[model samples]
Structures are given as C-alpha cells and as structure tokens.
Target chain A: MSFPKLWSFHGGLRLDGHKQESTRLPLRAARLPERLVFPLLRRDGRLAAPGAKPGDRVLKGQLIAGGDERLDPPIHASTSGRVRSIEELPLPHPSGLAGPCLVIEADGEDAAVEIEGLANYREHPPEELLRRVHQAGIVGLGGAAFPTAVKLAPAGRRIDTLIVNGAECEPYITCDDSLLRHRADEVLQGAELLRHILHAERCLLAIESDMPEALTTAERALREGGFDRIAVVPVPAIYPTGGEKQLIRVLTGREVPARGLPADVGVVCHNVGTVAAAYRAVVLGETLTSRIVTVTGRGVRQPQNLEVRLGTAIADLVAQCGGYTDEAERLILGGPLMGFALPSDELPIVKSAHCVLVAGRGELAGSRPAQPCIRCGACAEVCPAQLLPQQLYWYSRSDQLERVLDHRLFDCIECGCCDVVCPSHIPLVQYFRAAKGKAIAKQREREQADRARRRFEARQARKAEEARERAEAARRKKENLEKSAVPEIRQAIERARRKRAEKTDQHATSDTPGRS
Target chain B: MLALLAVCLLFALFGLLLSYASRRFKVEGDPLVDKIDAMLPQTQCGQCGYPGCRPYAVALARGEADINQCPPGGEDGVKNLAELLGVESKPLDTARGTEKPKAVAVIDEAACIGCTLCLQTCPVDAILGASKFMHTVIAAECTGCELCLAPCPVDCIRMAPVRETAATWRWPEPGAVRP
Candidate 1:
C-alpha cells in the first residue's frame, strides 16, 4: 500500500547512508561487562545525585541516581552489583574533562530489582500514566534527552496530534529502525497509549521513505494489532527529517514558532523508541535498563547492532566486538552529524547514545582543513530553519556578539546540512556552537552584575535607616535627662570637665616631664 | 488678510502639539550617572574616598571624580565605566587596593567574644547577631569590602575567597583558553 503523501522541509541533504554494515546482521545481545560506571551526570550534563553509597548492594534495575524526572531522568543499575566507588571517570565528551560517576562491580547474578507494574493502563487516568512514565525515567531517546513528562503535560495548552518519529535519519544510527522492524507491535502499542495520554485525535508515525522495509513491517503490525487510530507515513529521506520541528513541518505543514515548543502549535512529538519504552514501562514492569545500540564503522572488526545495557563501559563492548581494526582512527559517540568524539574508551554509553562510530584512517574523506568562505549562498539555501549561516559565521568569528544576537543566532539548530554543501569547507556548526556559548556566558555575567548592584543599593538604604534611628535615640535620651531635673545637666557638665582635666594631666606628665 | 490669519491659527495648533509631545517624553534624572553606576561593581568599599558608589557616580557625572580612582573596580571595570561616560580609560589607583578576587567574611565563632565591634564596622550590615551572642555574616549579601575585618576585637574574621562549584564552572572561553 502507498504511504501517505509528504511535504518538504526547507533545506536538507541526502548524505550517503552508511547503515549497511550494521543492519546486515539481525540485532544481537551484548555480553555483560564486569563493571558498569554510571556517570553521575545525567546525559543532559546535570549532576545525578547518587541514591546508593559505596559498598551498598544494588539489585538490577534499582534506582541508583537522579532525584526527580522533571529536570532530568532517573538512572538505574544495569545489573545486580556492589557499589565500588563514586569518583571521577572519563566521560563521553570532546572537552576531555572527567565527570563524576558511580562505579558498580557486577556480581554476575543479574537479579531484578523489586518493583511493581500496572495490570491495565487504560483503567488509570492520564495523570497517573504521566507519573508512571516519569518514574520509569523515560526521555526522548533521540539525541536530546528532554524529560518526556514535561511535554505530555498540557499545562493549559491544547494538543491535537501526536507524532511518533521513526525516521532514523542520521546515517549508521539504526536503533529506532531495528526496534520498529522487530518490535513494531510494541512500538504501535506504545503509540496508542501516547495518543490516549495526550488526548490527541490522530496519531501518525513518520518514517523515512528510504526505509520502506521497516515502514511496511510497522504498518502491517498496526493493522494486525487493530490499531485503527494510528497510521504510518513515510516522508522523504532527508538528513534532519527527524528533527522535532522539521518532522512536524514535513507531516502536518505547520512550523513550531521560534523560541517555543511543538505543544504551542497543538502538537507533541516523541521518538518511536521513547514510545516503545513507555509501553514497556507501563505493561512489563521494566525500567529503561537496556536499549538497541548501533556499533558500526569500517574501523570496527565486527560491526553490528546490539542490545546493550545502560552504564556499560564502551571499552568492554569494543573488546566483545573483536576489538577495533588497525586502521581505526577516531572514536565518536553519536551520529557523525551531531555527535562528538569520545576522549577515551572508558566513558560509559549514556541513554542518549544511539551509535558508537569508529572511523578508519580514510573513513572521513571530505572532512579536511577548513577553507575560507566564497560568499556562496549554499548554506542559507540548505538551512531548514532558513537562518543566514554565512552572516552568523562572519559575526561570530569577529567576536561581534551583540551583532550576532541581533541576527537571531540561536535559531540555527546545528544540523550540519550547511557544512556538507559548503564549497570552502568551513565548519559552520562549530563556529555557531562557540558563539552561542560565549553569548550565554556574557549574558550570565551581566545578570550577576545587575544583581550585585541591587543588593548594594539595598544595603545602603538599610544603613541610612539605622543611622537615623540611632540619632533619634540619642536625642530622646538627652531630652529625658533634661526633663527629669534641671540641675542634672549642670552636674553632667561638671563630670565631663573633670574627665577632660584628668586626660590632659596624664598627657602632661607622660610628655612634658613636669615642665608644665 | 484672512489667509494670513488662517496660517497663524495652523501654526498655533502645531506648536501646542509639539510642546505637549516634548513634555510627555521628557526624561528624568541623569541617565549617564545611572549607566556609570551600573558599570561600577557597587562594592561600596569607600576605597575611592567616596561614601558609596552612587555618590561617586554622581561626582563622575558632574565631572569631579576621575575614572581612575576606583581600585575595587579593576582596570576592566574602569574601562567599562569610561566607555559609558565617554572618557579615556586609565589605570586603577594603587593607594586603595589591588584588584582582588571575590571574597566573603567568615567569622570564627569560637574565637569571637560577641563584642559586636564588627557589627558596627560593617558598611553593609551583613553581620547578624544580638549584643551578647555570636555573629554570622550573610554570605549572599556580603560585598567582600573587608571593613569588618579590622574591628573584630579577637581577630576572628577571615576574608575567604569564593570557590567555584560544578554549576558555577563553565567551559573555558574558546581560543583564550584552549580546551
């Protein structure tokens, strides 16, 4: 059957889909690693305060860190283990700075944590379903681990549609594709639940047209499961089609306003993997313990997709996959478009990690020394957000922050489509990221200065008030002394004169030596 | 003669509208002084020989105080203030004090005699205590002016520099500090 007709986003690229090496093999189960270092910092770079201390025994799937899901998702132990230590460890970041992490040594038992699950989710109201999702530590697994519960809460906003994103647009990141292919029934089941929770009239699952096989599988599962409310739509295979705004635009022909969210425009979007996780969270009594991770690249000896447990060290997975080839050069954590290079293999795979990319010496063919821009408008042409990448590049490079701010610098999503087509090979996205950081830091400094100024003013006002009260008290005391007795003032004057004479007499004896 | 009278009447109406617009949009106070005060750190240290930053700002607005007098406001601070006031930036005065890191006073409660001497010396009244009890400085409101350090009878006060926490820490500025 023909998929639903699609509309086009402004600009994108059809980058070579380097997905074959991994998808050739059916999904595999990763071997258990001996030690799991759960980064105390959540995937959003927030501190995940530990719930267990060192030497404490933690069962598999037990809550190990994170306080509330409103700000960040809670982290769970991947296997039954003993807390080894909580200290600094190499993290999955380009900066090379270490992060706080909880080290747990597995006991090989794989015992499950004691928890309860819902028997029938439909019996519960929508608010209860939201709480369950929050407790299960569910997030948008697509790069941005935005807390899902925040989006589901209408908070006085009306929503009409729920979009399930199964595009898997980034090359070599096929976890969502595999999940849809194998677990279509579960994904749709989760989508139906999401539709109900959001109170949306229609639920649409958008997949990239290139992945026809997965789309057919998902649609057949939808029909077999009698989920008439949900339909599968295949959009063009464009890079960044899975971006929340771009996906919404491609499917519904609506643009999420700048500096706003999808719910503002009567819609909400979730990754298909996120939806499937929600389904399992409500029905199967499972936390987000494991997910399908793509381990592929020319540099890897055995490139395939595997269901790896969260908090598992990357080095162990590399060893289990027959180690890296001699030609391996750089190790990247996510898709090449938006991911950063991992400083070391000791960094654990985080929840937002969808791929472990190992590029051989020549794998990055076009990525070379950046050249000067040729005043070409290609970047602006391909920008899905329709931002002026060239103008921002010039303003940012010159450190003209105010000028760039006026030009709407934050609107660029850093999708790497412009970098792909630039004739001069300028890394436009890098410039934008640096400029954004500088801008934010400057804004913070100004705010602090303003706060200091207000406090100083308040302090001065308080001091003046105190001085006034003190002077009034002294005046009232003198008046009381005069009113009590008329001769009291004369007596006080005599006492003051005697005290002054004594001070002068002492000074004369000490300095003049009786000459006076 | 009638045409000339018509022209005079039109001129009167336009003049009234213009005057009303000017009066309605008249700005109050010296904006330059407020802007200059904003550039100052507002430490109220009295290091510049002014009672507070606001009086010093007034003097600057009146062209009486030099831009170089504020030592608490370091060279960058002076530069910012000068830029706002349309004057040439100069070095900070060495007599007051050198540019210092942000600091706060921490009282050694055990050593403190509860004499309340520091309470009177603090310009900001950041210290809180009864006459015979131990005093504690509110860290948030403290200006790090060092005025309270001199009057502590037992020398129980220490000027402690602020430490950076994980939240306060930032990725070093690109190019200035590589990685």
Candidate 2:
C-alpha cells in the first residue's frame, strides 16, 4: 500500500482509536422508532415549513415538508406513517429548544411512495441533476449538514477543481475510514458523478495517510472504474487535516481565504460520505434513507459501525452496539472534538450523525482547576489556523467587541487544537465561542434596530403623504366655489335646496305608502 | 592608510545594511492578539496569576499565558482560545482547578428581597427585572463564572447545573478509562 501522494499538517495529537473491536463487525441495521419526530429544519439551522397536515397518511420517502427555495432543503418522511400532529417537539439542537415538528405514528408497514427514477441520470443535464438532489433532501452528512444541491450548483465563477474529503481526521471517527475500506467503489462512482456535475478539470480524493488499507482500496477502485482524472491523494493524519479548508490547502496548496469557501478558489469540496450518498441518489435514484455510522467508545458493550436510518433513536443504536456499560457516564454524537454531547438516548439520529460514543465516567473524570495562564506559548505552537488563542481569550473575557473582530474572530474554525495542547487548560474555545455568540447577538440587535428605524421612516413618509392629500382636496373645493359668480352661486344654492327637498319628499312618500 | 580607510568604510556600509535588514524583517505581531485577549474570561481574577487578562494575552502573544487559566471560562473557553491561538491543548491545568461540566447561575427565588446587586455585577446584562423585583438570570447569557453567586448578601444565589441537552452532551473523556 504505497500512498505516494499523501500530505499532512503539523500540530495534531493522535489518540488511541480503539477501532479494532468494531472495525470488523459487519454493518447492522437499526430498528425503527415507533413514532418519528422529523424536524423541518436540518441545514444551516433554517427551519423548513410543514407540507403535510395532521392525519395525512404519508409513505416512506414521501415529501412531507419543503424548505424555502432560497435557503432550505426539502424534508421527507423517513417511514410510512400517519401524521399524528404538527406540534412543537424537542429537536436535536444544541439549544435544546422545542421546534415545530411533524410527528408521525409508524404504520409498521415500510411502504414507500413511487419515486421517479432517472432513466439515465448520468445523461441528464447538471441543472436537472441538482434539481433532483434538492428535491431529495440531500445534505452534507459529514455533520455540517450544508445543502448538497447548493454545493453542486455552479458558482458565479468557474470551478476548476473538486476535492473529495476522505480524511476521517477525528480520533474515534472511522465511519469514513471504514467506508473507504469497504465501499471504495461507491465513493469513486460518486466522485465521477460529482466531476460530471461540476464539469471540473481535476478531481482529487484526499484521504489520511494513516489508513493504508483504505488508500489501497480506494486506488484499486479508482483504477478498476477507469477514473483516470481522479487521483487518490493521502493527507497527513492531523487532527483537523480533514477540515475542508485545511484539507484543501494541504492537497492543492491553495489557501481558502479566511471566511471564504473552497468554491471561491475554484474548488468545491465534498465529504466522501456525502459523495457516496450522491451516488446512491443519482445512480440508483435512492433518497438519503440510511447511512453508515461509527459506534465506538470505552463504555459500549460492543463497538461497531452500523447502517442506520435517518430517524433512528440513539437508544436503539446503542442497543445494537450491545447496550452501554454501567460505567458509561457520557454519550456524544459525532466525533469527540466536534461532536455534541447528547442529553439523552431518545434523541433521533439525523443525516449529520456520524459517530455515537458511550464513554465511561472514569474515562471522563479528570477535573482540573483552571490556573492562571503563565504566558506559555504552547497554544500558538499547535494552532493550525496560525491564530493567537491567548489574546482572543483576553479580549473576549473583557467584553471588548472591537478587538475581537479585529483579530478575525470569525475565521476561527473552533477545532479545539489550542485547548488540547495548552499546558494550562485555559478553556480557550469557550471564550472564542462566547465572543462569537456575543458578536452574533450584537449583529442581530443591530439588524433589528435598523429594521425599526426603516419602519419608523416609512410610517412618517406615509403620514406626510396623507396630510398633503387632505390639504390638496380642501384647496380644490375652495377654488371651485371661488370661480362661480353671485348669480351662479344663488342658482347653485337653489339647485342644492331642490335636491334636498326632493330627497326628503321621496323618503316621506315611501314611508306614507308603506303605512297605507 | 587609504586601504585602512576603505576597510573602515566597508565595515560601516555593512553595519548600515544590517540595521536596515533587521528593521525591515522584524516579525509583525499577530493581529489575533487583541481578539484572543478579548475572549479571555475577564474575571481579572488573576487566576491566570498575571496582572490581568490583557497582560496575560501579551505574554501569550510573546509565548506566555498557558492555554489553561481562567476557571470561570471552563473547557469551552479553553477550546475557543485553542482555536484562536492555533495550538493543541491537553487537559485543563490540574494546578488551576479541574474543568467541570456546564452550570448556570440560579437565584434562590425564595430568598426574601431583590437587592439588585447581582444585576449590576453581570457583565452581559444577563439578569432581568427591575431593582425591586426578583431578578432572574438569563441562563443563555450566564457564563456560569460564579461571580454573581458570591455577591448575594443573603446567599440567595446558587450555581445550578445547566440542563443537559442532546447538543451539550459530550462523550466522557477517554482518559476516564481505568486501566
């Protein structure tokens, strides 16, 4: 397994993967939840509006809710069911706030609505292909959940390169690694489809150099499939070498501008898992029904990667992994660094779920009292973004908003590198997050204030216009009266008197006739 | 004598070039210093043991300020600083205090009167209601520094454990494994 083209970055720590227990186990299917609560919002935090009413019978893969075309992806039914109700339910969100959800009671019959398969999807135009992808509710399954169609769509500028990210850079995450080892062919096929869609000149599949087996498997698949233009490039096993921007820089040596996207530099990056999903969608006309998820940690009775449905509960997934050990103190969704800590096992797995870890209490039991920073330079040594973490922490702590922005606070990817290597655990990431949150809140406040100002201005303009119209009407009436002579005025007065008299006479006549 | 003068002139020219080169090539300080400084938990608690968070940030930029300092900032703050500084981190400095999970500021709603002291102390304006009314801490804005907890004259303020959501749930550290 000679992975000649592998590249990596500096400053990443290698934790024990503990993958042996689960890597060899064949993928298992997760049992369905009795009731499915599907959130209308999945991508970029924008909520999708409900398309179905209460009591509507929906089949699996049926469109139940649709996103606003501008920023949302359409949502579909995960199973055949009757709409129980459209109500507020606890969504799988960090905020833990209840969002509007479509609740469905499973009918136990996995019935699916008829889907229109592309007779020759590969032959279809790129625009049409992207349209189907949007309608299919495809999102980046690699945890970002970015809308896939938006990535596939041609940018305002030309796209020359497409990088397929296969760097399963997180310590415990092996879903992508396993996918490469087991399903390399699908990944390559997906890559080819992406190339065709983007019409890109170069297609590079970037994988970590650690997994030699995956590299070989991917190489063989690429060669067997005759994808000559697609190169399987191995990146170094850095912690966040798998981050889109970092991977792009390592592979192409092109720095994705800070806060800018790979597409801005004529490159579009896709997660290997995302590409596999695309292949399934475009090649087999399959919707995103199931995905390969890595289930490994110290607290699980068993550890293995399993194929699970979109709305499967974490509890069911855990049971599939032979249930949790008594020592299991915490459960995390996704990888250890970026994964969210799950409040409960009842949370449903969505498209972005990659790993479900059950770690023991003892495994997480170290509590260090935060000490004063002794001005150690260790954080800068490990920052892949070349940022000054200590300074940002200071400004954020002081609530100095201007200095935080000046430091390009938005460019921080929150990868947890500086905190990991710090001699003193400064909780650097929290300060950055606090600053970012404060910044966002401040921006929202400013926007609201601007909107209020605009409304006030509009109201004032309307009021002035109304007053002017009233004054104009009064002047016109006065002019008409002034233009008339004395005789004309007398005649007009007599006419008005006659008209009033006639109206009174008619009213009296009608009343008298009715009485008679 | 002329050759000696020529040699002296050559030395002077070399000295000038060296000074000019040194000035031109001096490493510019990172712009992220200010931002990283702002993100520091400004309890000015001197928990980082420096004069303040600002001095610590300068030291951090000058390769000072260990990533693990302010206990008030906790693990989240450490992670943010790590991201900002572009460094890897280990466990929180055990010397400072172990990083605990998320907690929120809780006011014992039953503790008689609202003195409004906690409201004035809150940096983010997290406390709500008038001076006379019972004030509440907005859990979202509360950093859980326990700064507000100490100011309560009646010991009415308590640090309540933050509600765990699927989002805040993290896998227990692998080191928790006892061999």
Candidate 3:
C-alpha cells in the first residue's frame, strides 16, 4: 500500500541497524530481583519526595514517592515489597554521582494492589483524562521522561495532529517495536484516546520503514479496533529520526518554534510506548510500575527484550539475560549514540531507560584524543538542528557564553549527528552540553540578582517611607502643642489685664479720696 | 559679507537644535552607576567596605573604589567589571576577604536565643521571625552573605555548603588533557 508523502529533516546518519539479534526471540517476563532501588529523583534530575517510609509494606502499583503533577510525576511500587532504608545510592548518570533512592526488598508474593479500570473513558472530559494520566505517572518513555500530562494539555493550543512516535530510531532498541507487535491493539486504543483528548482531526503513528512487522501489525490493529482517524505511517529508518522535533518535522512539514514545544506547532507528539502506557493507565486504572526493557549487545550472552520493572538494578537484568559475556567491556544506558557510560551495574533503572547496551571491547567507537577543528564545515552540514557546531565548539572552549548564546546554543538537540560527522572527533556534543549548563546557570544567576535587586529596592523605598512618616508625625506633634499653647496664653493675658484694671481702679479710688 | 552672515545664522540654528535635543533626551541618573550595579551580583554583602552593592557601584562609577574589592563577585566578577569599565582586570583584593563557595546560613533553632539580632542584620530580610521566636533563613533569598554570623549571640547559625546531586550537577568545563 502506498503511504502518504513524507517530509524530511535536515541531516541524519544511516548507521548499521543492529536490531535483529534482540528481536529474534519473543518478549519475556524478567525475573524479579531481590531488591529494587527507586531513586527519589526523577529522570530529569528533580527530587520525587518519598511517601513511603522505611519498614512500610508497599503493594505493587502503590504510590511510593510523590512529586509535582506537571514537572515531576509520582513513582509507584513495581512489586509488593517492604520498604528498605532510603539513602544515597549510585545512579545511572554520565557524572557517576549518587542520589537519594528508596530501596524496597521484594516480598516474593508478587501480590498487586486492588485496581478498578474505567469502562467508560470516552464519557470523561479531557481534563479528567489528563488528571488520570498524571496520577498514573506516565512519562515519555522514548527516553526524555518528560511528564506526559503536561504535554497533553497543550495549554490552550489548537492541536490538529497527534504523532505517536514508533520509529525507535536508535539501534538495538526494539522495546517499542516489540510492544507494537504484541500489543498493537492497546497501542491503537491509546492513539484513539489521545485523539479524543486532543480533539485532533488526525492521528499518525510513525514507525520505521525497516520494521515491516510492527508497521503491519499496527495497521491491522488500527483496522480491527475501528480507530478510523488513526493512520500508521512508515518513516525512513534514519538515525535520530525518532527525536520529537525530527519526527514531527518528518510527519508534518512544520517546524516547532525554537525554545518552544510541539504543541506550539498545532501538534502534540508522544512516544508509542507512552501512548500504550496512557491507555493502560486510564482504562485499566494501573499506574506505570514497570516497562519493557531491551537487554542486547555483543557483550551479553542473550540479547532480547524483557518486560522489566522499574528500579530493577542493572545487574539483575544482565543476570536475567544470562549474564554478561567475557568481552563485556562497558555498560552504557540507552543507545550507543546518545547513551552515557554507566559507572556500575548496581545503579537502578528509571523510567527513561529503554535499552541497556553492554558493549564489548571495540564494539563501539573508542575514545581518541580530539584534534583542533579543521574548519571542514562537515559538522554544520550534518547538524539536525541546523546549527554551526564548529562555531559553538570554539565559543564553548574559550568560555564565551554570550557568543554561544547568540549562536542559538539552546537549539542543539545533542543528537550526535554532528559528532559523527566531525572529522576532528571534537566530542562536540559534550562541549555543547557543558555550555548549555553554564548558560542556564548564568540565566538563573541573573534572575536571582534581579530578584535580590528588586527586594533591596523595595526595602529602601519602605525605609524611606517610614522615615518620612516619622518626621511628619514629629512635626505634627510640635504644631499641635503650639496651637493649644497659643489659646491658653491668650486667656492668661486677658485675665491678667482684667486683674490689673481692677487693681488700678482700686488705687485710683484711694488716690482720688486722698487728692480730694 | 552676506555669505559670512548666512554662515553665522546657520551655526546658531544648529547650536539651538543641539541644546533642544539634549534637553529632550535628558538622562535622569548616572547610567554608568546603573551599568556597574547590574554587574555587582547584588549580594548586598558589605565586603567591598561599602554599605551595600549600590553604594559600591556608585563609588566605582565615581572613581572612588576599585573594582576588585567585592569578594562574592570573585575573579570572574572582576574580569567582567574590568571589561565593562575598560580597565585592566586585577586580582581580588584579599584584604577584604577571600572568595568563598556559595553557601547559605542555617539557624540551629534549639540554640537560637530568639534575640532577633540576625533578623535585624539581614539586609534582604530573608530571615523570618519575631521577638523571642526562632528565626529561619530563606535559603533562596539568602545571598550566602555571612553578615548574620556576627550578630547571633548563641552562635546558632552556620554556613552549610550546597551539595551537588544529579539535579544540581553541571557538566564540568572541558579542560586540556591532550596526550
């Protein structure tokens, strides 16, 4: 069948599709680990305050940590377990730092909390759907882990299309594809629900053209479920095509405004995994406790996708996949292009994790000393965000933050397309990331300075006002005393005059008698 | 002779226009002071030997104070000021105080004498308390100025260093590690 005409983004790479090894086997349930360590911080690095204390028994799907509705979503227990001590633990981060995590020891019963699914989700208003999505703690599972409810609301923007991203553009990440193959109906149901919530005219599910099985199954599910408004479209299997902005551009010939969101372009995009999770959340009334994780790489003995619970340690997943091979040289979370090298296997998985790639020695690109930029302009040619990576690198290296900002530094998506094309191997994305951090810090400092300046000025004005009022009060008191004293002095003078007149009259009479 | 008179009248007309333009666009205050104040970081700390950031800014604008006297602004701050004022950047004047890491004061509520000394001393009014009641510093508002340390009779306040976590972690600036 002929698909509709598709638009293209600026620059992308055609990397080796190392996806077959994982998709060869069917999806399997992961073995439960003895302990699950849930970091109190969300994937975006904000704290999710713990609601369950130590020693408290938490059932599966129970809320363990609570967070703000929009930015931070509440975390739920993946399995029935007793709360262990919440303390500092190694986290999955490029910095290899530690954060506060809620530890839970599995009770082995695997019992779940009582849940009630909504039978008539269609009747509920869009606000109710967003509220349920927020309570379910569903985030963009394609790896940003941004709160889904916030994206769905659109803040009064008119949405014409909803893009369900199934591209799974990153190599070796087949969790989304496997979800489509197995639960296409649920995914389609989610698309329909999203369409209803958005009141969009059309819903397009964009899958990679390479995954014919996923495309067919999703289309079939669309027909069987009678989701007439939803269409399954196949996009080119190019690296970084699955990015929110890139996918939106490919699906619709529109550009989301810089520093804005997809909603700004009259569209809202969500990962296919996030859409399915939303369906389950609103219909089944189940909170997002577990997700499908792909454990694959040349370093692992068995490479396949497993439905794993969140907060499961990396070591547990590796063991469940028959443990790491002898050549397992490094553990990288997500994919080779954008993922970071994890420090240890003890770090627990969070919502954003899609793949745990344990690469063998020389399996991926080895680090080399970066040479000075040759100014080949190749990085600029391949930058998906249409940025001058070379200029950004120069400014970032010299700590020229203002110039970097003037170059539209925030628009760089860090998709590694420029890094791949850079002949100097400058690690361009790292410089951009560091520069972005500095810029944000600079902005925050400016804000604080402005705030402090305002407060100081306010205080000065208040003190000046108080001094003026005090001076005015003192002057009024002096004037009132003078006013009252003037009248009293006048009465005293009149009385003195009368007394003197009386004395003079008496003297006059006595003098007259003497004179007579 | 006629040409000379015409030239004189034209000069007079141009001079009148210049004066009127200047009066129409008269600036209210010293813009140099505002520019210097904007770069001062607004800590309100008197480490510069002035009463506050604005006073120091005024002094700098008036050529009365050096640009390196602010300890909170640090070396970078000095560099920015130097660039702004077209002066050579100088090292921080350590006689005032050495630059310290950003930190906020935390009052030990138990030991707080309820003396309100810190409350009265806080320039920003970041501390919230009444007479005979324990005071707490709003960390977001506190500029990490240690002026409150001197006034506390019971020594309840201490500067707690901010911890770096995944949330607060910044990608470190790249250093030269070339082989």
TM-score of chain A of each: 0.92, 0.90, 0.90
TM-score of each: 0.85, 0.70, 0.90
Off by over 4 Å in 2: A1-10, A42-46, A67-70, A364-367, A485-516, B1-179
State which candidate has the highest TM-score: 3
Looking at model 2 chain A, which ten-residue stretch has the lowest summed lDDT?
A448-457
- lDDT string for model 3 (A1-516, tens) is 234789999988888889998999899888887899998876565677888999999999999998555778899999998998999998887778888889999998888887787769888888988988998999999998989998888887999999999999988889999999999998989988988999999999999999999999998888787877888999999888998899999989899889998998999999999999999999999999889999999999999999989999989999888899999998999998889888789889889999999998888873766888999999888888899999999999999999999999999988888888877778888899999988888888889988988888888888899999999999998666656758886677679889999999999999998998
List lDDT for all candidates, in order: 0.83, 0.75, 0.89
DockQ, all models: 0.23, 0.03, 0.50
Which candidate number would show the highest lDDT if scored against the true structure?
3
lDDT of 1 by residue, B1-179 (tens): 99999999999999999999999998898888888887777677788888878889999999999888887778978888778878788888887788988899999988888899888777666789878899999987777888888878789999999764434444443344545
lDDT for A358 in candidate 2 is 84
Colliding pairs, model 3: none
Q: Write the per-residue lDDT of candidate 2 for residues A1-516, one digit (tens) a residue.
A: 123443445455665555566676766666776787777654444456788899999888888887548446677788888999987666666555566677888898989877766747667888888877777778887788888889887568688889899988887778888888889999988888888899898789988878888999999998788888798987777778888888877877788888777888899999999998888777777777677888888888888888777777788888878898888888888776676666778777778889988877756422455666777878777777878888787787777888988988888888888877767767677678767877875565445334433433354466679999999999998777757677878688779989999999999998997898
Clashes of each: 0, 90, 0
Q: Which digits, one per residue and each the tens of the lDDT, describe model 1 over residues A210-324? A: 8877889998998799888888998888998999999999988888999999999999999998999889888777888888888888788988888898888887777777789
TM-score of each candidate's B chain against the true B chain: 0.84, 0.57, 0.90
Q: RMSDs, each prediction?
A: 5.4, 18.2, 7.4
Residue A83 of candidate 3: its Cα lDDT? 99
In candidate 3 the C-alpha lDDT for residue A115 amounts to 74
User: Which stretch of 10 consecutive residues in model 1 chain A shows the poorest summed lDDT?
Assistant: A1-10
Q: For candidate 3, give the lDDT.
A: 0.89
